[model samples]
Target: MDSIRFENVSKSFGKTKIINNLNLSIEKGERLILLGPSGCGKSTILRMISGLETITTGNLYLNGKLANDVDSGDRDIAMVFQNYALYPHMTIEENVGYGLRIHKEKKDVIRQRVKEAIDILNLTGLEGRYPKELSGGQRQRVALARAIVKRSDFFLLDEPLSNLDAQLRGQARKELVRIHEMYGQTFIYVTHDQIEAMTVGQRIALLNGGDLQMLDTPHNVYHRPANIFVAKFIGSPSMNILTVKMDGRDLVLGGQRVELPEMWQKKIHEKEGRGLKMGIRPENVVFSREKGPYSVKVNIHYVENYGNRVGFYTEIDGEELISIMPEDEFAKGEDVYWNILPEKLHFFDGETTMSIGYPAELS
Candidate 1:
């Protein structure tokens, strides 16, 4: 059974629609990331699942039970917000076990659960310390400890690591994976951070303008994006997109015929005389001193060195493209010959702005 399911779910505030007919099913024990830019309704989805926001339409099922009308406290779920909401007046132990106290659980049970959570969070000696005495990272861990002691199988984390520095966030992210493995629980992480979503989530649901853009494995969503929005949003440097016109079996970009894989020939013939969008990642682009077929002359505008490699932003036939490669002897305004991997080409329909899947092999 699906752990969480949203069937035609929609949320609105007055006349403004926040989520428009979202349909998704999250499996138990899965780490799913709701990723999108701000105001995309990702956070609203989390709020609805937590019972903090009322669903305007359709149903939300939790573990095969209708959860639209369920009380947040009775749902057996724990949430960690972006801000560490630890009580400043209480010790770490007291803060971690506060929920048990609220539920009026036995003192002995609370003590044992608090100890386990402390051990898991590596807060052996710091248990006596208050939130005001701890660092930001430590305070963040205290929030997690509170959730951990709750012993809920479902976790809702809303950018819980966003407040930490880069190094601390990296460390916390690894710990979160370890904790999830140890507990074997379902994690619903909401974030606009692409790095966190790419590394932490097994499946990613991308939202845009209150609409579900794409939902799939991280690899598929990265490599086989559903549309232009997804194609651009997930990548770090983003994919290089060029508007092209179909020239018989060739793709004419910038009024020049661009070399592409043979597999696209049949597809292009079927879509003859149509305008399409061509996508290629920066890493797939290669530069060589020796020029051959498919090589285009480009004027390098800027080169950014990242220690291990370099990024070359160049213009070719009026189309700007980015190519990341090893440190090479190239200067600004220099003419360079570059080529893109044929197999890595991404084709999209211009009108609908959706991916046009080319067959793997034509028999």
Candidate 2:
């Protein structure tokens, strides 16, 4: 078993800190993705694990053994880089067997290992091809094949599919997931792509501003974000957030009374005199052809069609909000009433930006 553990890891250069005091653990054979925006230390974490970057403080453990001082080559790990890092002068087979060759492995053994990797990556008939002759996806496969051939205890991937075209990236995502399933090896994949993080990872570690926000299943990360940054970052079409005030006995936004479910009313009752932010996902807000209770009439600013679904962009009380509808359902420049289901509403403390939900479930 090759479990990976980071105990209060920190990294810095000059006056800039890249990774803060971070702590995490991953079980053997678990596929984990590190996701965040650029410069958020996602790739830095991967490089630290690969032993390419030295940790400034704390210890790294591999299968319960301290690995803070381990050499990159001796870490029993394989890394697939974003650029595919293949040797242009070498043929596919030679490139895949390069590491083993350098270690002075027997000719027959290297040949068998390379052949196995080629078969696993479906590069069987392309053994003699050069990196320059292959397509983007093919070269990526070659890179992954080289790593897979190592048969290491852990696989570290640093945005391996970013160089491919959008269409090819989608195809590669499926292939990578299939490869993980086939091998059942511990994989630490790093990417800034939210779709890739959502689709490929069995679990995700969401990092932001050099801080670990939440580490949970994709569903939890998406639906129950740890704080405001995550709540606004993880969803498509973005969740709509509005500043609200508790006016006497009502939650008021833009001088309009908002109706919330009884359960939610109790949840925010203690914070009645304080400021709050209400969030509603685009899909959770409904548009009615007629006015209803707590409904706000808005002018349709624009409409965007996403094949099966349509996003109705509107201006309500000097603020822009979107309502997702069926593609064939609505038109631009039409007046409509929009409202949110109280139970689905998310309330956050204005000062702290932390969500107000079930404490046990959230914490």
Candidate 3:
């Protein structure tokens, strides 16, 4: 049985629907990332699963049992919120064991569980420190320890690393995976940050405007996006898109005709006269001054230098395209030649914004 399941679920606030006709299943021992921007209902979905928010329609199941009417406390989930939610007056051990104490567990059992949690989280020596006395990262670990001590059925973390510094956040991301590995419970993490979703999740459920855009392995979502929103959202600089027309198997773009990938040539005949958008990741656009088989001349409009690599926003055919290179080689207004990697091109139906296909192997 699935760990958690939502069938045709919808949530609302009076007149506004926050989550619309959603259907999702989270597997046992699987780490799923609920990813989207602010106000996208990702958090609401988490809350609903925890039984803190009511499901307006459809069914919610926890461990193959109906859970729509279940109380939050009875859900057997350990959630770490963005703010850590630690008590200022309690020491680390006290905070960690508070939940067990509330359940009337024996003092000895609570102490053992709390010790195991704190030790696993590297808080072994700092058990005596209060939440206010520890550093931000230390306190974040404390929040994790508190949840860990519960040994709950599911672990729900809602942007728990948001408050950490960049370096510490990166460290905590690895730490979270370690914690998950140690516990091996069903994990659902909600975050607006794409990096967290990509790095930590075994699978990603990308949502937007209360709609589930796609749910798949991270590689598939990144390389073979279902639609334009996902293609644009998952990448660092976002994929560069150009609307093109299929001229009897040749792609017509920017008043220039370029040969489509061989895999597309066979598919193009049936799609003639169809308006399509060709997407290319910034990393796949090779920048050089030399002409190539499929080349485009562009004027650099913006240069973003990130020490090890450089990003250029260029204008071509009235559309802004992004390209990244390892070293600084071009300047603003400097005309340059760049070629799109044939196999990396993604074709999208113009009207539907859904992927037509990418260059793929035919069985």
lDDT of each: 0.87, 0.85, 0.89
- Compared with the true structure, what per-residue lDDT tens digits does model 2 show for residues 1-363? 549999999999878999999999998999999999999999999989889999999889988899999998888888899998899999999899998888788899888989988997889889998999999889999999888877788999999999999998898899888888888889999999989999999899999878898899998888887778888888888788878766655677666676654566677876665578888888988887887766766778798888999888876556678888775476778877776566567788888888877433233
Q: After superposition, how far is residue 210 of candidate 3 from its true place, in Å?
A: 0.6
**Model 2: worst 10 consecutive residues (lDDT sum):** 354-363
Q: Rank the candidates by lDDT, best first.
A: 3, 1, 2
The TM-score ranking, best first, is: 3, 1, 2
User: In model 3, which range of ten residues has the least summed lDDT?
Assistant: 354-363
Candidate 2: the clashing residue pairs are: none
- The ten-residue window of minimal lDDT in model 1 covers 247-256
The digit string of per-residue lDDT tens for model 3 on 49-99 reads: 998899999999999999999999999999999999998989888999999
Better of 2 and 3 by TM-score: 3
Question: Cα lDDT for residue 290, model 2?
Answer: 80
lDDT of 1 at 310: 91
